[model samples]
Target: MPDSPYVAMGPRVAIRHTERNDRAEFTRLSRTSAALHHPWLTAPSTDEAFDIFMTKLERDDHEGFLVCLPETGAIAGFINVNSIVRGAFQGGTIGYGAFAPHAGHGYVSEGLGLVLAYAFGPLGLHRIEVNIQPGNEASLALVKRYGFRLEGFSPDYLYIEGAWRDHERYAITSDMFEAQG
Candidate 1:
């Protein structure tokens, strides 16, 4: 457990489900992050990536949103709640990235609170998980701020930046949020 600079910082933020009209801006930001963090993804043409992103946006069972700064109308970050499973589990995995310029501003932290509320409150999801690369200290800290518990480490969990990387799994349950509330 390393100390986190984002333990408590930044002005609060709000997020809204990404709309069809937001596709162009979302695509630009996501692509920029991918280029910086996972250059191998650069080969995909914008249209090709837009199609893939639209698929995520169109799913009813899943959610994708952009974190917006009220004053500037800037998109600080984006989050996705995907692979939702119901029945005995009733869980989903969360994925997110901050716009390059917004990194380290605690924007994602505030946006995370909103995501958790939506996940546990409106979405009726019982549990949400986040998988972070071992080296992504910022993301790990962001998830921790929302009370996600370290579950385990997985090898070859995901392929990004042209190579497979290990991931640290963290999970939070609706019960925990309810108790905290």
Candidate 2:
């Protein structure tokens, strides 16, 4: 939390499901944050792409959340838990990104913390996994602060920027998160 000056100032944010009406703002922010995201992430930046993205979230395996400042209702960032599993394995992988205006302010951390709480509580998840490109120092630090442990590395684990990219895997279970909190 000390990593963000805004965190010290007591930033208050709310997390909610991403809605279809958010299309305009979501794509706008995605386009604006292109510089911050390129090589490290890819987000829907067009009407068609967003339509497709929204469709994917309709599935039981996927859920998306937008983090916003309650006072103004402006979106700070978004997180999506994908590939959720039930029954024996109750968990999912998370992918998140911050908008340019909110990137360094720690809204991402707040949003992530809230989402993880939801996952472990209402979602009844046993664990969650996060995958980060090795060069993405910001992402790595974000996860580390949340008590996620480095599990391993995978070569060409994800395709980004038109090429296969390596990723460092990190994971945290309900027990781990609760212990740290």
Write down the lDDT of every candidate, Cα atoms only.
0.75, 0.89
On the 0 to 100 scale, the lDDT of residue 150 in model 2 is: 95
Total clashing pairs for each candidate: 0, 0
For model 2, what is the error of residue 154's alpha carbon versus the real structure, in angstroms, after optimal superposition?
Answer: 0.9
Question: Model 1, range 1-181, lDDT digits (tens) per residue?
Answer: 1342122223666677766677677767766676555522231227667677768768876888678786667888877898888888889998877776787788877888878888887788999998888777777778877788999999988877667878999999998877767
Superposition TM-score, candidate 1 onto the true structure: 0.84
Query: Best lDDT goes to which candidate?
Result: 2
In Å, residue 80's CA in model 2 sits off its true spot by 0.6
Candidate 2 wrong stretches, greater than 4 Å: 1-11
lDDT (Cα) of model 1: 0.75
RMSD of each: 7.1, 5.3
